[model samples]
Target: MRLCPAPGGPAPLVVINHGSPARAADRPGLRPAACDSEAVQWFAARGFAVALPLRRGYGASGGDWAEGFGRCPQADFARAGRESARDILAAIEAARRLPAVSGDRPVVVVGQSAGGWGSLALASLNPPGIAAIVNMAGGRGGWAEGAPNTNCRPDLLASAAGEYGRSARVPTLWLYTANDSFFAPAIAQALHAAYTAGGGVAEYRALPGFGEDGHRLFFGRGGSAIWGAELGPWLAARLGRPLASGAAR
Candidate 1:
């Protein structure tokens, strides 16, 4: 994946990952996944330089996907621990070097869907110099069904979220789409449960833009506006003022 840095006090960095591994020029003709488009600009307006990575398999980043996960124990865990961490850490390092970012200020990691998982995993490590985190359409453990979905035990992701929420590590923003067919509402509730239980500070919000499609949020037409409205305030609170966890969607 590519890491695009903004120009200078390790300006607060926001990590954006593409959920699917599809290259920008794939047959799909390059649609935005994860958080891109207006969202990036909005964050940039807040003086935060965003770091977007294309992910390994789908993008130019070279890596062995088959050998890395291959039906092993917590294969997801192993890959996330090894590869995903490296990818995010690399982005963090590069973003910090930008002219806009201050060395003293940590980066803010934001992601959705698959990227959301990585963000949570990265957050668990609590790498040095991280300011805060935002998990949208993300989870703490695995899928409730545990089959068709790639990462079943996603609930485990909350360990890091739980820790962060309960302590002085970083402030967190949690956004969930009510009809998220991707992640059954139950699991979403579990995500909140784990974080709040962990004693962490998470600003939770809901959005209706996804409509009936469920997981295709990033691709949906209204997706951008929905997140922008909800995320905008959360970001404001993090970067400047306190915003609302509102909008019934």
Candidate 2:
């Protein structure tokens, strides 16, 4: 995994992307749709650093998608979770090296779909040093459901909760769309219940937009609504300052 550092001086970092965006050298003729570095720029402009990490199979990162990353879609959702756990561990290690990262400052993980699950997995496995998290349609509870699309296992979240969820308290935010094809809006509710039960704090909002749904809007230009609306303020608050509101255009 590689850390894409946001510009500007020292600032706390936010890590995003997992699953599909990850690179698997063995897989050919496949590419992740383009995404926005808005989180990097938006947070950097407001004085926070954004660390974008691509997991094993998606981008330029080199690795055999099968062994190094996670199991295949044919394996089952449980395999996806297993793979995600390894990637999350790598992303955390990489995040610590960012130049804009504040040693004393905690980080905010902003994830969409699979990335969001990784954020929770990280929180459940690591320390509260992570500060905060932002999830856009992160998968939850009904793990068996999204099997076709995600490799995430539902229970890993519980496993993470058992291992690291408690004691590692963090402020979290969620943004979801009701029409999410990858999962029903119920997944969002399950995410809320699970995170809270695991001893994490969270705030969320679910919207309505058919066709444009699915756990994809957390990045790219479409994700700006969540970023400019809730996430921007969240990072600002996490930093003990505030971002100018009306600036989104």
Candidate 3:
């Protein structure tokens, strides 16, 4: 886990989650985001103490791989998402216990790729203290067989999203790109339609493509500028004020 504490004594918490690697073998080598990374600094500058948890079964925190969604044709996306959510929820609780993190302010959950899918699952639980979720290119079953835009089972993925939306009342921000190689615009729109149709509260935004693949927009260099413009106002409305200006060192 990597923690970047805000300058203030106690501040709102933001737990950022990493995505699942396309290759199964890469899971063991995954690592948490650096504390001083641009993404973490962005939150820290905004008065949020950031915690990046390396979920179980990934990287140095290896255990049993609990997020497998079974074989492709009939992947159990819901189960896999739930398992991922469990870890994120735990991370939130643990982070809140830190002295630098205030319990009064609501928590913000941010995730990319599979991590974003987990954030959606976490919303269904409506865990207290979680005020909002920011899903950046979130989805599973993407790039099947290493092919761009290929999905393992998009139908099942959409179904799982709807299932989560049935009880997810927390407001969410869904950010995607026009040229995502993993989950294309069409797939992203379908997932959003299913989620909102099932009663999930979400605001969706599709931005212009970035770099080779828009899927990496959340963590890619210079990526923050594009997403931050949209995210800043959205977060201010919920937090009741604007984020602190200037970057945190």
Candidate 4:
């Protein structure tokens, strides 16, 4: 885990989860091997000690892909999400052991794409010190057969979401763009509905389309500008008063 502490004493934490690539080693060449440094910097500027955990079986942390859901035709999305959640929880425990971090401080988990789905699954566990979750274009089993926004079994996805929502107590922010190629607006709404219907506390916001694939919102240079306005108040409410003057932080 790469722990980047902000410019403050024992700042709160933001566990940033990264999305998965098709191949274990293929990190898209553009994105880093671990969490996006740009995102870590953004959270750090806001007085958050960020912990970016490279989950098992991805990148340098090699093993059998623990989060694999099986073949597309009969994927087990629920099992896959739970498998990914285990690594995230382990990362949180690892972060809690750091001397530079306060174990009791509020923790906000922010993830993109597959990472986002993992975050939702983590919500069900309600790990201690976690205040909120921010799911940016979060979903699983997207791009089935290389077709954008076409999941293998969307009902199963919703069912898994409902299962997560049934036991989740953490508040989550669901942010998706109108043109997300990975998860279209309709699918995003269905996921949100399933979550909320199952007693999860979530706030959904569908933003305007970004350049080309909106799935890159959390990875782009100016992505925070679109999410910062809403995130600031949410952070304040969950982590106490906002110490950062800049909204972009």
Question: Best by TM-score, which number?
Answer: 3
Tens-place lDDT digits, model 1, residues 1-249 = 334344333456677755533222452333333334555655655666667765554445555432133333344443453355567678778767767566567567877765665666566567887667777776422333344234445555444445434543456676776666556666666666776786655667765536674555644666667777766766666666553333221
Ranking by lDDT: 3, 4, 1, 2
lDDT of 4: 0.81
Model 1 TM-score, all chains together: 0.69
Q: Which lDDT values do the candidates have, in the order given?
A: 0.57, 0.56, 0.91, 0.81
Using all chains and alpha carbons, the TM-scores for the candidates as numbered come to 0.69, 0.70, 0.98, 0.92
Better candidate by TM-score, 2 or 3: 3
Kindly list the per-residue Cα lDDT of model 3 for residues 205-232, writing each as its tens digit: 9899999999999988999999999999
Question: 113-171 in candidate 2: lDDT tens per residue?
Answer: 66676665555555546777776676533334334333344445434433334534667
Candidate 2 matches the true fold with a TM-score of 0.70
Each candidate's clash count: 28, 9, 0, 0
Which candidate number has the best lDDT? Answer: 3
Which lDDT tens digits does candidate 4 get at residues 4-119? 76665787778888888744457423233233456666677677788888777765665567888888767788788888899999888888778767778778899888899999
Q: How many backbone clashes does candidate 2 have?
A: 9
Q: Which pairs clash inside model 2?
A: 21-58, 22-57, 22-58, 23-56, 23-57, 23-58, 24-57, 36-220, 80-151
| Cα lDDT for residue 133, candidate 1 | 73
Please say which candidate is ahead in lDDT: 1 or 4: 4
